[model samples]
Target chain A: MVNQQRFGLSLVALSCLVLTACDHNDNDEPAPMPPADVSYSYEVTVQNLTQGQPLSPVGVALHGDAVMWETGMPASEALEVLAEGGDNSDFIAVEGVLASATGAAPIGPGSSETVTVTVVNEPDTFISIATMLVNTNDAFAGITGHGLSELEVGQTMMMVLPVLDAGTEANSEAAGTIPGPADGGEGYNAERDDADLVSFHPGVVSADDGLMMSALTSAHRFDNPAVKLTITRTE
Target chain B: MKLKQLTSIMVATGLTALSGFSQAAELEITVQNLTRGIYFTPILITAHSPDQQLFNVGEAASTELQAMAEGGDISGLETAVDALSADTVANPAGGLLMPTAATTTTLSTMDGNTALSIVAMMLPTNDGFIGLNSWMIPEAPGTYTVYLNAYDAGTEANDEIRGGGAPGAPGLPVPPPLEDLVGNGGSGVTSEMTNATVHIHPGNLGDDEAAGGMSDISNTVQRWLNPVAMVTVTVSE
Candidate 1:
């Protein structure tokens, strides 16, 4: 009871000190000021949940309802560049993005990386995060147009994301086709040969499973809920 | 016609149609193919009691469930559910539900039917079907989404070849649309049954060969990951 009373008294004293400071400022005939612009910042942490596939540098953005990718729809050039290759340069340059950030390096299996995005004045209502599996043809995992506007400061949101096939490139899993540590070969190609629309990734069928030309083995096979992503509003 | 008949009978006998206090619910159900390449045969959707499971894992499938999973036919299963007084919507899509395609239907369930179940055989497989075994319908009105996995009924061998769809058949049923899509002239993948009970499918082992491989299914075209289907149910007030 004594500690509670003392804490209450200190709070009253602190308010009084602030009031005195405001009174001193009032003597200078201060003009009414408009509301200050606040910079909203969010930190997104992505953990790779695949066994052998390493995740590319996670690309994150805060934007409007304009989504990065849609299922059963052709992927935009920006998304193709990121999903086919491990490149996020074009994706971050997409228009209407309030703020964007990319991880420094690839996140391996069972590893995590945190990327921070900040926007000033604009309401960052939508959050989009995307990254490639790097071992497959065009498999990527992330969420797009996820609402974060209702998120308050210091609040965090968590979601387990499923893998999506970009459908820009065929999942041949051939030698010199994959871009990850397994193949260490080609990245993005302009040709749209496979299904031209994005959908859930029909997992990698390795060479062990009758895919003779597949550069991948059974070790590279992956399933749904490939990555665990957590978002937090820092400021 | 059956739903209308039930309504008319209740109207003619006008003495509180429900057996006791009403436990019925109106539902809007939507099923979508989440796979990139696969076709769902005529879907069998139903609302039944809590204890009436469609198919249970680690248990031998009922003959009615076996027929639906082996062939694309839901007649046997439909008849069995009718005997239980369950409300059902058979083949809402009218035909095959293609990859990424969705089908929606409304179900006005009877009293005591508080659980929902749906089953459909996926083409290109012998006894594999997408199964949602008796999910409890929520009392509150809201939208719910559930992902469904492919199950092997253990009634037939997963030969992955063209054959008749009768019960105890050795291969898959190829309808007219999938006639060209599925290849022919292949040796069987496996003739032995390791686990002779309803269980999670180990997925198809398709080969890159088009004509003369172990499995007629193309490795690049027919393989699927877990969660082959997505079901969204909206309980209306």
Candidate 2:
């Protein structure tokens, strides 16, 4: 774990050096032109904080001033697809996106993945990333459009994020409903049978706990802060 | 540019003058229950010297803290903080703080009071309480936000059955709001607390059967993850 974190940090530093060199040369050639390409490279590392839940393919996006999802509001079709099916294509295709990146594969329990997203000409952009606990119905963890403008060079911030329910699907935990290895079931159905507004997930009710038809067990249950996210600005 | 510099200088001077006159500070605090279905008993909020602590992880709970954790009583903790000359605000909600509700209180710190602590029992549990232990108050004047997690006192069994509310109570206290929500008439979950010290709560093991199950708490509606409450504090110089 320690070695992985160190390698991730070094990659971020190398990217920043490249971006800084590009910005310095652009300053001399600009005249009433577009904004300088003050690029920023960010390394986002996520750790699964759950006992048995394995997260789906992670989605990372950089947007200007818009949010992907909000509480007490109807979820966008892009968000609904990702929440139900763990697909990142629709979510990454959202408008006003400055840059985006997706993890190569799903992250398992006690595992960590470091993704590097580089946005050009948008150093003051807001970063948002999310991944679903594929064992549950619609639980996802990520940060919204948190301001990254004040992040100094080589500075890092660590935070633990709470799980949120997309409110597009009910947390039934039934057979053939979950998309992870726990059930090997279908993903991304276009239906809004549950609460439509986003809210905090109340966790799964496994068979050991009382849901007789639930495919999940006590071992598949989880709690808050299902993921630990660390953001570092290299340039 | 000159006006900007002058404004900065005057602001610094005013801050210095205000710090000199006040030996202590008056704080306005607000705590919000962010969960959907948890109940917080009367809360115990205190500002004390750095030497004192209400509770600590991996340490045994004091008799006063145990009383507040096992049951919903705060008088013992209130008196303990009073003896230490700590500023305290007891039962700010006047009653139980229901789910998705908020409460506010005010506490004035003494000259040496530099640390803050808050504790409150969670309903439908034998020995669980929301805890914030001895956080150092910042010297700078600003608004700060802190999140609190549920801690097990480890002094009693979490049978989850409806029973007494006293300090040494064996089962959960079925308050009015939770009376219809929690289950009833079930065999106990466990009689032993493996770690006999304050620790992160393993969370409630609620069952699905409403009338008869191993636990009186409903598995779907009663369980919570960490960070059940949020505390916002505004400091004045």
Could you say which candidate leads in lDDT? 1
Q: Against the true structure, what is model 1's DockQ?
A: 0.57
TM-scores of the models, in the order given: 0.87, 0.75
Give every collision pair in model 1. Answer: none
- Could you tell me the fnat of model 1? 0.65
Compute the lDDT of residue A44 as modeled in candidate 2. Answer: 88
Model 1 accuracy (lDDT, Cα): 0.89
List candidate 2 stretches off by more than 4 Å: A1-35, A47-52, A64-81, A88-98, A110-121, A153-170, A184-205, A208-211, A222-225, B1-23, B26-28, B34-36, B57-63, B100-106, B191-197
User: Can you write out model 2's per-residue Cα lDDT over B131-196, one digit (the tens) per residue?
Assistant: 999988777788999989999998898888888877787888777867787787988888876988
Q: Quote the positional error of residue B72 for candidate 1 in Å.
A: 1.2
Q: How much of the real interface does each model capture, measured as fnat? A: 0.65, 0.31
Docking class of 1: medium
What DockQ values do the models have?
Answer: 0.57, 0.21
- Per-prediction tally of clashes: 0, 2
Kindly report which residue stretches of model 1 are placed more than 4 angstroms away from their true locations once superposed.
Answer: A1-30, A122-124, B1-23
Encode model 1's per-residue lDDT on A1-235: one tens digit a residue: 9999999999999999999887754356568899999888999999999999999999998898878887768899889989989898888879988789999999999999998999888665798889999999989998888888789999999989888888889889999989998899789999999888878888999888778888999899888789999999998
